[model samples]
Target: MTATKIAIVGVGKIARDQHIPSITRNGAFELSATVSRHSGVDGVENFATIEELLAGRPDVGAVALCMPPQARFDAAWTAIKAGRHVLLEKPPGATVAEVEALIAAARDEGVALFATWHSRYAASVPAAKAWLAKRQVQSARITWKEDVRRWHPGQEWIWQPGGLGVFDPGINALSILTEILPQPVRVTAAELQFPDGRDAPIAAQLQFAGASGETVSADFDWRQTGPQTWNIEIETNDGQLKLSSGGAEMTIDGKVMMQEADSEYDGIYARFAQLVAETSIDVDLAPLVHVADAFMLGRRIVVDAFEM
Candidate 1:
């Protein structure tokens, strides 16, 4: 089969580090073009905007939108209207309603649409999910803390409304949780800590309840200065299962079961290829819905201003 000609929008750090490399390496896709206001990929056609890229590269069959959540809806809508398949980064849109709209548009246009959660494709996530399938979950705790300056330095949009702040990374944990657990969960209460001058929260505490009566708690903070942590621990009827390093490693009862390097974007591209071929849409909105629910029902607290 001929490879799908794909274009990338938003040539930021993720597009350069992950999306470009993954698409170039995947046999099912060919990197045909890029659209960015500032950065450009070498050896590929580049355009100043999505409009120009779409008009210039008629052969492109799909697009991977690596832009921020706030700007995703417009580009996605334009692409779907142009009858191109779309692959969206996590937290598909700034609002749940926008993603819902995109879903309808993609369906109406009869094109593939995938909202990728890279962490769900981590090396050990499936293993954790399989292990928990037969066991009873008692409780779960998720701690995702990192230094935003190190990860997203000088990205002012992160502090603005719709930037999602710490939830940007926290959603990764929720994605994994939603995937690995045997039953669905919902946010019951949330406490968000916003910086003095920021519109988004820098830290958050959330409580969740599973359909089977399991309890879950999440703590997301972007203020850590020392060792970074991305971990999820769950107590099951059999033993304790811990997924650390953002689902890259797994342990049961203090015994290491799995550990490997991450290939999240590679898996993302692979899944996108399958979706495009099948002409199907694979978008799980549970994680984003939980986020919206948190914002809607969460209590607000003022915290110290954060500086990068």
Candidate 2:
């Protein structure tokens, strides 16, 4: 079978670090072209914009959109309309409604649409989900704190209105939670802390309630400097489950149950290939919906100015 000709829509840090490598290693895809304003992949045809790339690369059968959530909807809509499969990075779109529209467009075009949550493909996430499915969850706590300067660097778009700030990483935890838990959850309360002069929040605390009456709380902060942490702990009828290192490790009752190197992007590309082959859409709106809910219902507080 001929490899699917895929074009990457963004050539930012994520596209270079993860998406490029994953695509190169996966036999189901070929890096045929790139759409970027400033950078391009070596040995691939480059275009200054998505419109130009779409028009030029008629052989391109799919597109992987690694652009910011704010710009994702337009590119995705265009690709779906062009009858090309699309793979979207986490936090699919700027809003829930936009992703819903993309779903409808993909269906109308009869093409695959995959909204990938890389954290969901972490090595231990499936095992953690399996373990929780057999047990009764009593309560859950999520703590995801990291230094934005170290991770995001000089990306100014992150502080903009639709950039999603702290929720960028927080949504990853929500993705894992939504996938592993047996019942659906809804946000009950949220407190968002925004740094002065920034449009988006820098930290957030959220309370959630599951249909089974289970309570889950999350604390997301982008101000941490030392000892960055990404952890989720859950209490069950049998014992306690803890997933640390951003789902890279899992422990039960303080004993390590699973630990391994993460191949999240690899898994993401593999799944995208499968979705493209099946001509199915796998865009889950649960995680993005929860983020939107938190922003809608949460109270905002202005804090100190964050200088990067």
TM-score of 2: 0.99
* Ten residues in sequence with the least summed lDDT for candidate 2: 49-58
- Give the Cα lDDT of each candidate: 0.94, 0.93
Model 1: lDDT to the true structure: 0.94
Regions of candidate 1 where Cα sits further than 4 Å from its true position: none
lDDT of 2 by residue, 89-130 (tens): 988999998999999999999999999999999888999999
- lDDT for residue 125 in candidate 2, whole number 0-100: 93
- Residue 14 deviation, candidate 2, in Å? 0.6
Query: Where is model 2 more than 4 Å wrong at Cα?
Result: none
Candidate RMSDs in Å, in order, are: 0.8, 0.8
